[model samples]
Target: MVNETPQVMTIAGTDSSGGAGMTADLNTFAAHGIYGANVVVSITAQNTQGVRQVQMITPDMVMAQLKAVADDLAIRAVKTGMLGDADTVHTVAKALQQFDFGPLILDPVMVAKGGAQLLSDAAVEAVRTALMPLATLITPNIPEAEVLTGMTIQTPDEIMAAADKLHAFGTQNILIKGGHGDAPVVMDYVRLTSGDHFWMKTTRFDTQRTHGTGDTISAAITAQLGLGLDLKSAIIAGKAYVDATIRDGILVGHGYGPLNHLAVVTAQNQPEVYDDI
Candidate 1:
């Protein structure tokens, strides 16, 4: 019998703690019953407490990894996490342009949950200029969205405005995650290229185990997309999946713990979707 599993790729860094980065992305793909592939862009020695030291992979090696994966695996969807610097970002962008590695889910992973900056200022510009246009979907947290759009996002209107600014960057879809806000309920705003948008609201669990929430969600979306789900459906499923992971918390490390990737999201954890702005 031929191997028939849907394959997805994650181009990101390594988190030694197994909480965030490529680890989380791969775990998410497995949980969603999808085959996972990776292109290591950076390596970090860290745990749930915090990131200690980081070593970025060379651009040539990054390109080599991309070619190796694209040459073999039938990658249906791909997502990017921490690209480290401007050079790596440009390299990844060029690779995406070169290969038909399926839809690109660009996760603008700027800072670690423990307050460590994962992306450089020059890298931010590189992503905005080079990667954004190639992204099928861009997932950015509130802080990341603010940084990318250069606007202070404090209200729902501001979030939509930021999404518009991000959409102008040429991405077909934008998901502005509201997890950084101090609200009882987290509202993630989505803007599609077809002039359709909505807000996905879920109860904010009072826990600190959101270490890999962003990666987990984006990976879930990629998995669904690889499985042939439409973009809107993939986004909705991703929100539900992450909500389950967060709600079913697991105790691993001291500081911000990692999400329970094994937790199965039931229909009860479905996010309340708002079709209006």
Candidate 2:
């Protein structure tokens, strides 16, 4: 007898409040019916209000966790989030290069929703130099995109320019998320390695429970990839999953609350897709 369930891994920090980071990633993976594995890089004492204290795991320990997971479970896809510092980033990147983890989804988590910096400035540079080249898909919000591309991203054209700059870093695909923008509709842009691009537009819900949105979406995509969906379809499905999770908000903490991962059980609002742009 053999197990055929899809298995996915999340390389990220832990949120004590269980609202974001590894917790959210596992929840999203479970919701998608995928087995979830994780390698903890840091720990944060945080809640919906803010991040209080952060303790980074040693690089050696991080490598041990990565090897332990890779040695046993047949991980089909992996996503990285909330890497604490430069050493940990380098360690994870090296381990990723050594292993055969199917698809690497880099979620370059920089600042927490509560104004806490999760990844150090030096680690950002490490990600650009090391992890970016290994990423199958890199998802960045406007601010992260600006930091990576060193350009102000205001208009759609600017987003395209930023994506081009990111693609030059060797990532096969890029998804510039528009959730941080002040628009009535959130337009997430996707640029594939084939030079095909598209925008996924969804109505911006006025809610404060979008804490783990980035992790959730990226985890959803990883799970889809583990289940053997094509990259484009997986991305579209991930967007839909996140849209439903945000639209159906859940009250958890005082400040930025967590998304309803179980919202997929209800109606899913599909994003309006615009391609060939």
The candidate that achieves the highest lDDT relative to the unseen native structure: 1
Query: Per-candidate TM vs. native?
Result: 0.98, 0.97
Could you give candidate 1's per-residue lDDT for residues 93-152 as a string of tens digits? 999999999999999999999999999999999999999999999999989998999999
Worst 10 residues of 1 by lDDT: 1-10
State residue 75's C-alpha deviation in candidate 2, in Å. 0.4
- TM-score attained by model 2: 0.97
Candidate 2 lDDT tens digits, 1-277: 3437789999999999998999999999999988999999998999999999999999999999999988888999999999989999999999998999899999999999988888888999999999999999999999999998899999899999999999998888999999995679899999999878999988889998899999999999999999999999999999999999888888898999999999863344788889834
Where in model 1 is the C-alpha error above 4 Å? 1-3
Screening candidate 2 with a backbone cut-off below 3 angstroms (N, C-alpha, C), the clashing residue pairs are none
lDDT of 2: 0.92
